[model samples]
Target chain A: MAFFEAKNITKFFGGLAAVNGVNFRVEQGQTYGLIGPNGSGKTTIFNLINGYFPLTTGEIYFGGRKISGLKTYRICQEGIGRTFQVVKPLKRMTVLDNVVASAFLRTRSKREAVRLAEETIAFCGLTAHKDKLAKSLPIASRKRLEITRALATKPKLLLLDETAAGLNPSEVDEAIRLIRKINESGITIIIVEHIMKVIMTISDRILAINHGMVIAEGTPAEVASNHEVVAAYLGEDYDAQS
Target chain B: MKQYSGAILLLAVMLVFPLAVQDAYYQHLMILVLLWVAIGSGWNLISGYAGQVLFGAAAFFGVGAYTAALLSHKLGISAWWGLPLGAVITFALALPFGWVCFRLRGPYFALATLALNEIFRHIATIWESLTEGMVGILVMQTFVSKVPYYYIALGIAVASVLTVEIVVRSRWGYYFVSIREDQDAAESLGIDTLRYKSVALCLSSCMIGLAGALYTNYMGFIDPRVVFSLHDVSIAAILVGIIGGVGTVSGPAVGAFIMVAVMEIFRSGGFGFLGKLSSATGSPFVATLTKYISEAHVLSFGLLVIFVILYLPNGVVGDWPILKKKLLFWRRQATV
Candidate 1:
């Protein structure tokens, strides 16, 4: 059995199917990349997996146990942590406190949570901004804070939604390095990213989708070369010559 | 230890205040201030820290006051027992209310609480046999002197403030602030936002309920209009929280004092100075002005709220640095 599997998951907002018959699986210790255009249901799939929205039809399994119907927090407790596409920092709290809040999920002790949070902060190279309020941090730091918060939860599978969306090129490279470090710690990662370079470099397997349906699956080279994936990105007009 | 020295000194002053001022009128005002301390702290916990604005604190307040009044009137027991019993009942009330109302966010949740306040007021008024309706319930005073009431109110106020201090420093405090900041992020991080929100509501309800029971014991009377009043009890509680500081632990204490002092000053026409000035001057204009000042207490209170929101925004404790800088600007200028 796969480490994490979404079996025919579908979601409907009234007549519109936000996610229609989507299926994907992530093996243990693999970085799975999901790429698509805006409103292509990438974030919706994350929401469905975390139980933020109820699935219309399908099942999600984590470590061979069904997890689709569980509550969002319960899904997190099951070792699946996630970050938002739009960074959601606890604005009034300091960066350390923001991570400490997430660390509370693993341990009830405040001291322990602080210690864990400090480690995560140091690991993510946010030590300098640790005392600064989350709202006061720049967008790059906020994105890193988002990942740092999720990392502190000690998840086996981390779902990162657009962590590189608003980052500069150097900042994006730093994020890629941080993600690589997290994956090196034997944690599985499923990333939804717009930057093709980051996704191509980091993803062990890539799933390409369009209009809520899977267009291609299985690798940077394979998906990048696929005709449908090309059409999805550049539109249907595909000629050999420029 | 150094951080708590200020709090410890303040507590010492509060302990000696009633003894230092034996005047019954002054003691009564202090009692009101302390009662507000509890109510404001309770409001701060859920509304400020947890970020769930409770527009109907009067619902729990009225329930607590009636619990005491009814216990004394119908059950033939000391109204003092209402303190513990009222807290329990208010906890029971808050649990289900939070479960239902917490589903709604922001203004919608606030509106639901407002509806709850109105519902309780109607229940108290319509249930004449039980609550004595608008005629009100009058409980006999347990003590002729206000000293005991002063100490009791002080204890409750201190406990309420301490409760906020301890909780905000703990894991629960982090959870509450996270929920206030972003419910989705908190939930994504595995914090059950609903359960934590309910926890904050129940704790706050119990604190406010205790104050209500104390109010019944001290004031010796409670009508639906007085205890469950939207303008008086409910709005007064919000004003205390806001005027002090929304989420700061010490904000409510500072806010409660200012609110009670402002209301009393306006209601008593600057503690009778206007009345005295009018009589001394024997001028028609002064007399009319005095009367207007006394009658316009609520209006002045509204103006004070607007002023605080516009200038302080964060309440006294939260905006202390700004206040300190502005107040000491003259000293800095002189040094320069």
Candidate 2:
């Protein structure tokens, strides 16, 4: 059985299908990539799976338990943590406070939460700016904080929404390495990113969606050469080495 | 270190107030100060930190007061028992109101809560058989001293400040702050913004309700007019919170202290300044000037609110660090 599966997941906004009958699965100890053009419903899929929005139709199974309509916080408590497409740090709070807040959901004691937050902050390379408010951080650091905040929830299956969108090439490389480290730490990761290089580099398997439907699914090499995947990329050759 | 010192100093002052002020009138004034501080701080919890402006504070306060009064007068239950009972009832009542208002944000929530205050006041007045109507309930205490009442009021105020501090530090507190910053962002992070909002409103109502119980016991009276005027307690709390700084923990306390002290001073002898000028000059218009004291307070409150929002958007306490930096900069400039 897959560790996380969304079977026949459908979401609509006033008769317009944002995500139309999508079925996908991620196994434990796997790294998957969700690549789609703008408006292809990648973030919407993330939203539906995490309970951010109610599904028009479908069931989501996490660790083999159906959890489609449960409250978002409860889903996080159940170890299905997620980051946002747009980084949403608690703008007024310090970096330490931002992480500590999410840590509270996992641990009851403030002391334990603080210790965990401190560790996560150092791990994310935000130790130097720990005392600064989240809004004061640069965009890349803000995105890192968002990831750390989600990780503090101790999720079994972590969904990262465009975590490498705004990073430079070197930063993208670092993020890819960090994401691999996260998965290596025993947390399965499904990353949705538009950066083709980072996506191909980090993903063991790639699922490409277009117009609210999956166009192709295969290994990075196969998906790179697949005619339909190339057509979805508007005929630009995807250099597998890039 | 500095924050702790300020807090300790304030606590010491409160502890010594009863002993320092022997006059019954002044002691009564001090009690009112403590009472308003609790109510304002409670209002800050929802409006300041959570960014949900509620105008139903008077309604919760009135319910608590009437609950305590009814329990004491009708069933002979002690005022102490009624305090927690009132808080629970108000918190329960807050749930439905929260459910309705949770769907409304910002100004709409404020208007809905203001409407609730009027609705509750009317219900209290019309429910004559139970609430004693507009005639109100009076409790001639079994004890003679007002010192016990003083201590209880002070204790509740301190507890309110501590509770707000703790909740702001907790995980739920972060959810509240996130909701305040951006609801959509909070939801995207898998935080249930509505549930956190409802929890904030419920907790805020409970604290305000407890303040109501204290007020009724201390004043020995319960009336819809006195207990349920949103313009009296609700507006005062919002204004104090704004003037002190909205979301900061100590903002409401500082705002409440300054507002009450100024109003009390004006009420006691500042109006008499015009009276003295009238007697000395035999001017009819001079006597008319003192009548404007209350109106002047209202005007001052309005002006202060505008100034704070426009210039000191963080409230006085939130701006302290900036002010200190600027002062240090100016001092270095002068020395050079």
The candidate scoring highest on lDDT is 1
lDDT by residue (tens digit), candidate 1, A1-242: 98999999999999998889998999999999999988999999999999999999999999999998999999999999899988999999999999999999989899999999999999999999999999999999999999999999999999999999888999999999999999999999999999998999999999998888999999899999988888888877762332
Interface RMSD values for the candidates, listed in order? Answer: 0.5, 2.3
User: Per-candidate DockQ versus the true complex?
Assistant: 0.93, 0.41
> What are the Cα lDDT values of the candidates?
0.94, 0.84
Estimate, for each residue in B1-336, the C-alpha lDDT of model 1 and write its tens digit. Answer: 999999999999989998899999999999999999999999999999999999999999999999999999999999999999999999999999999989999999999999999999999999898888999999999999999999999999999999999999999999999999999999999999999999999999999999999999999999999999999889999999999999999998999899889988999999999999999999999999999999999999899999999999998889999989988997899899
- Give the range where candidate 2 chain B is weakest over 10 consecutive residues by summed lDDT: B264-273
- Per-residue error for B306 in candidate 1, Å, reads 0.9
Per model, kept true contacts as a fraction are 0.94, 0.37
TM for every model, in the order presented, reads 0.98, 0.91
